[model samples]
Target: MGRIVAKVTVANPVDKSKSRTFDALVDTGASMLTLPTNWKKDLGDLAETRIAKVEFADQNIREIEICGPVSIQIEGFQKIFSEVAFLEMNTSDGMYEPLIGYIPLEQSGILVDMLGHRLKAAKYLDLK
Candidate 1:
């Protein structure tokens, strides 16, 4: 398997007018979208909050803050994620860019092509 990357846009659901575009790592190992703590201001005021326990590959666990609903755009699709975690770790700790995880990938109907190192839309069965 290879690393899948995509260009994504993150915005404040409350005010879509406020948003930022950037490249994000598409990580299936992650369950939720994660943005750098510095993006807090650009994401606008968070209306809700949650605590998430993140387990690293080394079996280390850490609790982090989650806030949303955030509007995320990928390719031509868009969805409002109810919660997004703000990574408090420093850039040196490998938290350099945003991460698009499984939740948003499934919600946005994005399919990962590992061999191609790209993302494609998941096809839905047309019952009609």
Candidate 2:
């Protein structure tokens, strides 16, 4: 298996001035954009909030804070509208570990090149 990571910029749709760009893990298993709760505050005010039950890799299902209406842009890709999940995760090495889910990738028409460990823009989005 290979790891896919990319630099992602997340900004509140209402206020694009407040944004953050950093390296994030491309996780196909993740249902949506997941960021550390610490950064959520910097995004200013989001449009809405929701609670979702997420099953972690440990097999424990827990409720999570999901905030949204943000613009997600991967370097060299068009921005896409999507919600974000504020999660409680600790990085032992003191680094930001945001996870980019499949939703934004599909929405942006970007595909993960696991073999090349890069992102490829699709010529056409699938209807099926």
Candidate 3:
């Protein structure tokens, strides 16, 4: 089986004036938008904080504070005030940066093309 990757956009919305946008893979299995720890500070400091525990694939659970209002944009749609997870690791590498998971996708009402590896407006998919 080959690897499946979905391209998505993540932005720091705290400083709307200097907001930054970057692309990342869409991990459908992920529950929230995951970003590099630095992004939390880069977006002009943490906006909000919440106490939550995240479980990893290996059954390892880590306590995390989700700070956000981080915005997510995809295929011309944008979801403002999107809640995201401030992960411990920086995923900014070649072809892989951070991830926009099902959270924003559901909020924006977009459909994931599992085989095509692309995003389409949910309305488009609804017609099919």
Q: Candidate 3: give the clashing pairs.
A: none
lDDT values, one for every candidate: 0.79, 0.88, 0.67
Model 2: ten consecutive residues of lowest lDDT: 45-54
Q: Compare the candidates by TM-score and give the number of the best one.
A: 2
Q: What is the lDDT of residue 50 in candidate 3?
A: 87
TM-score of each model, in listed order = 0.85, 0.93, 0.76
Clashes of 1: 0
The weakest ten consecutive residues by lDDT in model 3 span 1-10
lDDT of 2 by residue, 36-125 (tens): 989988899986578889999899998889888888998889888888998888788889788888888889899888888889999999
What lDDT does candidate 3 reach at residue 49? 70
Instruction: Give the CA lDDT, 0 to 100, for residue 87 in model 1.
Output: 75
Clashing pairs in 1: none
Model 3: lDDT of residue 66: 84
